[model samples]
Structure formats: C-alpha cells, structure tokens
Target: MTGSREALPDVDGSGLTLGDRAAIALTEYRNGNHQALGELVREATPLLWHTVRAQGVEHDAAEDVVQSTWVALVRHAETIAEPKAVLKWLLVTAKRAAWEAVRKHRDDEKRRTELPDDSPEHPTSLPAKDPLPDAQVLSDERDRILWSSLQQLPRRCQELLRLVSLADRPDYRYISAAIGMPMGSIGSTRGRCLAKLRTILDEQGDFSWT
Candidate 1:
C-alpha cells in the first residue's frame, strides 16, 4: 500500500499536502497520538469517496467501502514501505473494497432473485388467509405486496432495511456495527431504500397509503 498516491483536494494546510498530512498522521498515530487517526479519517475520506464512487458503487455502499478501507489502513499502516504514499494506498484500498461490495451485492441479488423465481408468489403472504374482516384482509394483502416489493431492492438496501426493522428503532450504531455499514450513513440509506420500495408500489398503483 505505497507509491504514487497524491494529495487530496480541499484539505489544505500550512503549505502541506494531504499526503504530507497522512505521513505526519501515520507517524503520530504510531507514536501514541490517537487524534492523528481522526485527522487521517478527515483528510482522506473525500478522496476515498470519489475513488469508490467512480467504480459505480452507490453512495451508501461507497460510504461503507471507504470506512472499511480506513479500517484496513489502520491495521496495515505500518506495513507501508512509503508513508508518503498513503493517499495512493488509501485510494487503492477503497477501490478494492468498492469492487468487493459491488460483487457481493450482485451475488446476493442473484441468489434472492433465484429463490423467488423457484418459490411461489405469496410464499409468506396469503397463506390460508386468516379469517378476518374484509378491511383487515385487504390491509394484509397490501402489506404483503409492500414486503415483496422491499425484497426487489438491491441486496445492500434489503440488508439495511432488514437491520433497521430488526433493531426496534434504536440508534443505527447497533445496526452499523453488526453489519459493518458506516454509522454515519445508515439513515440516508434507509430513506433511499424505503423510497425505492414506495416508488415500486406507486408504479403498480394498487396500494393506497392514504
């Protein structure tokens, strides 16, 4: 993780480049300056953001990839032969993580899609529909449609949505830690996923929320 990394934009300092900050931060971090680690995150995050995004990863997944890259950098920072090349190292790491996330996301989507193809529609819905008032039965039917639509989302979105639902509305920190998602991004990702679900439902025009 060394060689040819350049200075990041918008993180100007006292005539120092982002690469320079990285070197100083690495040394300070190794020398017991925990704050340097924070500086490192601040300095390199934007560069990593664009690096990962350029690979076609969505914003939320890119956030997670970037976070993982930083974690990896912290673990392997000392292995770098050239601390001055830290920015390049970070870009490489983030890009690799983004590619990995994309692959995994696609694989998971394939598996889920295959499952649904082999399984019956209403697999979890309309199973011997419980005897209920007409209104409740229709409600359950609409809810089932919503549930199925949620599954149609990208795997990353499905995972975050499932975790959010399971967490009983606690702080996303728990979900983030459990799933390795970036804590700073859980809310927006959730919002986007839910919006996707609603959009799908709206396109069908069969479910009325009002």
Candidate 2:
C-alpha cells in the first residue's frame, strides 16, 4: 500500500522536489509518522537502485543492499537530525551495505571450503562484455569508448549523470534526490557532469560521437 505521505501533493510534475517535501517527510518520520517514511522510500528507490549498482554491485545484490540500507535508515531515524542529509546517508549506507554483503558471501564460501579467511571467494566481478549493439568492430569500439568515458566520472557524478540522462520527470526531482543535492543545484550538477564527460572524451580524442 502506498504510504500516507504519498497523498502529499506533488510539488512539481516530477512528483515532488526533494527539498521541501523530503524535509517534511523526514520531519514527519521523526515525529512518529512511519507512513511518511514509506512514501519517502518509494520516491527514492530509483536513486538508491542506481547508487548501489554504480558501486559495481550486480542488479539483484544491489537491490538487496538498497533495501537493507532503507531498513537501517528506519532503525536509525532517531539519530539523523537533518532531512537534507538523508540522501547522503542513504547513498553511503547502501554502498557500505553492499560491501558488507559481499564480504559475508566471501566468508561463507571460505568456511564451506575449509580455507583460510584470506582465501574467501571474490565478489562476482562486473560484466565485462561490451554492451555495444551488434555491429562492425569499429562501431563496437566507439561504444566501448563512450562507456569508458562514463566510467571515468567521480562515483557520485557517474550516478547523477546516469539517472539524469534517463529522467522522465520534467521537473527533475528524481535527479536532485539521486545526486543528494538541493533542487536548485540540479541544473548546475547536470552541466558539470556533462562538462566532465566532454573533457574525458576530448582527452581520449574520441570526438566521433559528437
């Protein structure tokens, strides 16, 4: 069921900008409004999903890590004083949860194999196959170059740009939450990420995509 906070009026067509609405939601949660927290989670899931995946966690495992992070947020809600800080808390918490899960998986495998802890199985690596469409090798190379350019961004910038690129909400609240920035900052962050990507491509001399 959607939370009571879901009934909150959408601040913009984007379904509520992260600033006022998120701040209110956190305040509601702090005042013992649990449903408000649920609404916040629903609105924020896509950001969390992208955040965990950007850390090299696979889709399924990352999903689990994100959920666990939200659960942790609820448990720690009393301690988090600022609503604006939720996004940052969620991002860092999700990444750490992902790493913790990876570590546990490795330890489990080591115990099963009767090996030293140092011999624990490695986390499954990111898929290495180029995601290029079926095409000539030259086109595939270009695709790889573009993706490599994306990977070169700072971890937070990569997550922000990736989500913003796919944003459907005209108001861009999703983009703001995904990047943990104020609504006013979304436009500038977009420009900065674009500029960084451009510089990377320019440095690599792969202006063919332009």
Candidate 3:
C-alpha cells in the first residue's frame, strides 16, 4: 500500500473514458440519482488513484484523496464550465488535495514532538479531514427541480428509473443485479418507470420539451 502504482481502467473495455461519459452522468446526478455516480466512479477511480499517488501520496492517503476529489466533483459538477474536461478537473483537484494531505501529515508529526506524552492533547491542532464519502452532499437548482419530479414516482419505479438512466447501455442482467428484478420483468419495469417519470414532469411543469 505504501508503494506508488497506477491502475488505469481500459478505455477500450468500456469504449470510452470516464470523462467522455461525464455529460451523461452529470445529467443523471443532477437529478439526484447516485447510480450515475457509482458508474462514474467505476470508470474513473483508477485515473484518480494514479494522479493522487503521483504526487508522492502514500497509497492509503491517496485513496482518501481520490474519494474526496470525487465527492468534490459531485458537489461542484453543476458549476464546472466544461463537462467534457471532467477528468482534467478531477486530476487537478486530487493533486491539490494530495499536497495538502502531505503537508498536514508532516506538520502533524512535527507538532506531536512539541507535546510530550504528559502534555494535554488539543484536538484542534489536528487538521480537519474532508467529510466521509457518504456524508458529502450533492445539490444544485437543477438537482432540486429534477428530484421534485422523481419523488412522485413509486419506490420501485424510482429504483428502476435510476438504474436505467445511469447505465451506459440497457443491460437487463445488470438491472437484475441492481434492483433484483427478474429478467422477464426488466423491460416492462424500465418502460413503465420512464413513462411515469415523463408523466410526473408534465404534471409538475418541471420542464417543457419541444
């Protein structure tokens, strides 16, 4: 774990880079669907891992940096001017976070020497850590509007909707895994979910598609 190593995802395997899929994923995420993010992370975590570790961050700390960078992306996706440049943005952010981690770890070591074991410990001296991945919040106006529409769907429909929308391709097997739907039912469930979503949008006047 201490050694630096790169784990690059095979673009040919997915037929596209994580950044290449960012536009689609962002649209799903803005609608408050986290399944899109799971897809993004699967495609991009390797690149992010390499970037963070390239900064001399140890494996464990680098892992944390990579996670935080993704969390930041979720939080800031709506504001990023170029969605196509998602990978570049993530690498840059991870590098910065890596540097901060290295500096703080070094400083923490130095300060530990200043305080003898008998000295009263001051928790404030420790650097603040980024929130755990699940604790991070993703939001924006578009997210709010989309979420309002999604909320109207039945729970089963919401699950199907999120799975179908975020997947790069319609894989019934995957839907079976994601939502425990039998193969025979996946197609109908997806169709119904989409129809329900459209109906909710129209009824709520969420958006008018020409």
Which candidate number maximizes lDDT?
Answer: 2
Across residues 1-210, which tens digit of lDDT does each residue of candidate 3 receive?
Answer: 111112222334656544556545665566678786788788767656654554556667888998899889988977766554555566568778988987787677667765454343653334353222231233544455467677678867765565445444533344343355676887877788888878767776656464
Per-residue lDDT of candidate 2, residues 135-160 (tens digit):
56536766667678888888667777
Candidate closest to the true structure, highest TM-score: 2
Over 4 Å off, model 2: 1-16, 106-157, 163-192, 198-210
Assess candidate 3 and give its TM-score to the true structure.
Answer: 0.44
- Give RMSD (Å) of candidate 3 vs. truth: 16.1
Q: What is the lDDT of residue 177 in candidate 2?
A: 54
CA shift of 101, model 2, Å: 2.1
Query: Each model's TM-score?
Result: 0.47, 0.55, 0.44
Predict model 2's lDDT versus the native: 0.66
Off by over 4 Å in 1: 1-13, 114-210
Pairwise lDDT winner, candidates 2 and 3: 2
Q: Give lDDT for model 1.
A: 0.64
Better of 1 and 3 by lDDT: 1
